[model samples]
Target: MNIRNLAATFVIALFGFFTLNLGLDYGLRNTVPHVLQRRLLNRVTADVVAIGNSVIASGFDVAAFDRASGMHSINAGLGAAEFAQQYVAWKLVTNERTDIKQVVFGTFDYSVTNTKPTKWTTWHSNNALPFYADPSWSIRYGCASRADEVVYLLARRVPLFTERGGLWTKVETLRRYLGGVGFPAAQINRFGRISDSKLLLEQNTEVFERLGRSIVETRVPLVDPVADLLKEAQQKGIASFMVLMPLPADRRSFYAMPGWKAYVVYLRELLSQTGTRLIEATEWSDSREDFADFVHLSEIGAAKFSTRLSEAMQCAK
Candidate 1:
């Protein structure tokens, strides 16, 4: 090829690459993790920052928690988010406001396993990519961690491949969220709350039952990373708490999965050794109506749980 033609081609490729990445970042606004990034940047001060997966996001009643505890609070939960992503978010929030006094991490043993379905790109991990110092930093790490996103970036050109890459069902999620036309019963309200509604009628009746069938793995990929985060929190005199939020009555059978009980025991022991408080949902209450689905808490359920949480924790009130 002629030198001029080669130079033109190179410029086109670079421009295309940047455009693709920026589009994905813009589309990510539909997700909880992307919104959390904006939340982290705002000069929002809080005494407590609740961090976890969607369960925590839906289950923790931020308004109730703040009112009952007498501490300003915000929920920094992300769907499918695990420890490393949350730790990074913790750093970003702490960097912005030195006032965060406590961390409430709602998690389960099953989440720690490194058994994501092939082609899934976790939002917790993906959302952090844009925060890198340069574009290449995110592209390099993103491709390394989850190449499927790379495929999805290009797949939009193919007629048959219309589905979104990563965990997204479609690209409309971003627009739906950004436009404030979120799902029927669940919309992102104040403090990132996703209020429960009958509009979110259960589609998969067997979801919890399916979860019950999966064997729970005992391994945690970010063990040391979490330990390090705890150490840093301790240094700053910030208290850390972990909540094993409840599963629906029928799906609570997940506890019976082989090794799951042991995993819980291991987690409890690990938390005790690490000096973090552990709260099991069954310890104080077990209301069947609290669950929106097999895993998440309904709005009423979250309010009840948060009240109980405040009543139980000395630091909370």
Candidate 2:
């Protein structure tokens, strides 16, 4: 063959190889976002759907809530998700399913603000074409629209950015699963007895003060399209509520910036204007040890907190 014909043949082969690899990657990683997992909770149907970031994702157990309240529930939490991304996800789900009688949004300081957009990783988009169609949002424009796409596409060919944390967590999860232990039990038990609660509280207060400063500087407006959606839901006889997930005890002092108290008061007042109830899980004193991080729940903490949430919901009803 001539050189041109030879080069053409090599190019065609390379294209075929990439297409096949991307297909495999999508198959392995793509699953519904945890927030959308409400479809599988039970045959009984849920009266409520909870949505938020990692705190809501790792901290709330829908199955336990369902059993405790006799109300089917689904936790649609996303990890590391900012409000803009979350708003898109919520819009997509509610647009498709109208039966979701209520939505419980786990509000947090960061959830109300915007952040620099992150690049779209293959793990997040799952090789889905539609994921790239909308590029107007500030976060999408910042992260996905840069030359990073070329880097991501090339990295996929080499498995250079494979999810190490997810893989390790999955293995740990499987070990627990095979041993017939329930979720988060091992992590919770690792802490042992809980006497020095005040020590952790002091630490948390510092963290909260720092977080509060960020909130004030960004002035990122609270993103609650849910008020409009709730109006539609109420017209159709549905209900909605917003819950502010608790922080570690020391978060308040650690993160106590100038506007922190005012911000909290603002959130409460905003919820009232929309006629949606607010549940402050942070008000409970015994709730701090359940956290896996400063903000997320260890599995044991999630179960305990979910039970408390169920009880609170019942009282609200």
Evaluated with lDDT, which candidate comes out highest? 1
> Candidate 1, overall lDDT?
0.59
Model 1 agreement with the true structure over 128-181: per-residue lDDT tens digits: 323322333233323445455566455434322221333344444565566665
What TM-score would candidate 2 get against the native?
Answer: 0.62
Whole-model Cα lDDT of every candidate shown, in order: 0.59, 0.56
Residues 1-317, model 2: lDDT tens digits: 99999999999998887676665446444334422433333224457777776667777798888878787776666655545445444554455566677777786554544344444453442122214223332234224545775554555343214322234455766775788455354333223223332233334545556666656555555553344444545565556677777776655543345656756665666666556677877644345567765556678788877888888877876
Q: Each model's number of backbone clashes? A: 0, 22
Error in Å for residue 268 of model 2: 2.3
lDDT score at residue 277, model 1, on the 0-100 scale: 81
User: Positional deviation of 229 in candidate 2, in angstroms?
Assistant: 6.7
| Clash tally for model 1 | 0
